[model samples]
Target: MSTPSGNGDQTRRDIQQTRAELGETVAALTAKTDVKTRARTKATTAVGGLRGRVTEAGQSAKTRATQLARTVSQKASQRVTSVRQKSQHTVGAIQGSAKASAQTAGKAESSVVTSARAMSTRIGSSVRTKPLPVLAVTGAAATLAVITYRRRRFR
Candidate 1:
């Protein structure tokens, strides 16, 4: 009779422990099913994802901007170098033309001087050879010049 009573008491304790475990599991499941809490967790996850995407976009834009700036800078440098080279070439051409013109002018001046000197020598020799005839011709030329000048002034 005493052994049966002890077995009955042990069975009652086991049932109580099982009931306690079941209650805990039900509480845990109810908490998991709470709509507000689940919504809040989902919202938090979405915000974190959005933040990560925004950071990635910002980094990508920065990289593209840096690359564009480098490209523009390289183009500007090339243009500057090209313009400088062209200007140097133009200046060299102008200098060469100026030097050639100066040389041509110097040669023309020498030619004119030589021709004038030769003409002057010929006239002086001709005058000394026939002084009387030269004087008569000179007087006749002076009289004709006076008559032509008077006619133009009257008209």
Candidate 2:
């Protein structure tokens, strides 16, 4: 009879302790479910997500700009190289034309000199062989020159 009474008392104590722990758990759950606290937590999570997206967008824009700059720089370099090659080709053509023209001019000058020398030799030989006839032809040419000069002056 005494043992049964003690067991009954201990069971009541255990039940009371369990009831107190359950009450504390319910209170904690109620605080966690408050509307203001839940809204604040959600807002903090949303802001963190937005910030991460913005950072990602900024990095993407920077990478695209860098790629575009490199492409533009490469194109400019290629254009410069093309222009330089074209200019070199044009200069080569001009130099070749100048050399050919110089050669032609040299040939023409040589031909003229040779013809003049031949004509001088022929004239010298004719003068030595026939001085009288040459003097008579000279007199006639002098008379014609005087007549032409007088006609121009009268006009």
Candidate 3:
């Protein structure tokens, strides 16, 4: 069987619990009614998110720029090396050509010198052996040159 005292005690406990729940509901309503505070909170949260995105984007751009710089630097170095190699090859070719030309000139010069010496010896011997014939030939050569010159001048 139920006792009247037990029932009364249970009713008081229920009333107290209902009052506590009502107070919590009123506090929640008051907080919702505070428009300025709610707006500030929302704006603060939005600004925090925007800052995070901005930071990430800035870092990404910086990384891309660094990569581009490195690429440009590497390409420039490669171009320099290529030009250096080509110039070296060209210089080597020129040096070889110069050496060959010098050798050919030396040979030609020596040949000319030898021919001149032989001609000088022959002319000396001929002059010693036949002075009269040499003088007559020289006089004839001079006369022929003067006649050829006069013809050209008159023309």
TM-score of each: 0.57, 0.52, 0.56
In model 3, which range of ten residues has the least summed lDDT?
A: 132-141
lDDT of 1 by residue, 25-68 (tens): 99999989899998999999999999999999978965775565
RMSD (Å) per prediction: 33.9, 34.0, 32.9
Q: Write the per-residue lDDT of candidate 2 for residues 1-155, one digit (tens) a residue.
A: 35788899999999999999999999999988898989999999999999999999978965775565555555555655664675576556555655665577755455555555665576577558856544444544555565567569869
Judged by TM-score relative to the true structure, which candidate is superior, 2 or 3?
3
* Per-model lDDT: 0.68, 0.68, 0.69
All candidates in order of TM-score, best leading = 1, 3, 2
- For candidate 3, the per-residue lDDT at 125 reads 77
Pairs with backbone N, CA or C atoms under 3 Å apart (clashes), candidate 1: none
Better of 1 and 3 by TM-score: 1
Ranking by lDDT: 3, 2, 1
- Model 3 C-alpha lDDT versus the unseen true structure: 0.69
* Residue 30 miss distance in model 3 (angstroms): 1.1
Query: Candidate 3's residue-wise lDDT over 57-123, tens digit each?
Result: 9789657755655555555556556646755765565556556655777555555555556655765
